[model samples]
Target: MAEYKPGEMDISVQEKTFDGFISMVTKGAILCILVLIFMALVNA
Candidate 1:
């Protein structure tokens, strides 16, 4: 059986996926904010 070791496993893929997720969420939030501002300006 393999021994368990903390902080010894590769997490490059997980880090990349998380970074992409964060970037997507940030962009989506910015787009929503901009749309809200536009709607408010137009009195919609």
Candidate 2:
């Protein structure tokens, strides 16, 4: 087994938060783009 280092857990937590934030932003962007496309199609 690998030795556990101090502060490693904190880094992992931060990484998870960062990943979640990025995922949320990406999803929001995709949703906005999809809505725009749908609106354009309806208006056309």
Candidate 3:
């Protein structure tokens, strides 16, 4: 049976997930703003 200390792995995975989530959210927000600006320019 493979064994690992769950506590350390859990913390590592949680931090990685949080970092990825923040990056994705930031990128999504920027993309949304860019799209909105493009739409506004097109409408103008």
Q: What ordering of candidates by TM-score runs from best to worst?
A: 1, 2, 3
Flag regions of model 2 displaced more than 4 Å.
1-9
On lDDT, the leading prediction is 1
**Candidate 1 residues 1-44, lDDT tens each?**
99999999999999999999999999999999999999999995
Give all TM-scores, in the order shown.
0.89, 0.78, 0.76
The whole-model lDDT of each prediction reads 0.98, 0.93, 0.91
Candidate with the larger TM-score of 1 and 2: 1
lDDT of 1: 0.98
Count residue pairs with overlapping backbones in model 1.
0
How displaced is residue 38 in candidate 3, in Å? 0.1
Pitting candidate 2 against candidate 3, the one with the higher lDDT is 2
Q: Using lDDT as the measure, what is the rank order of every candidate, best first?
A: 1, 2, 3
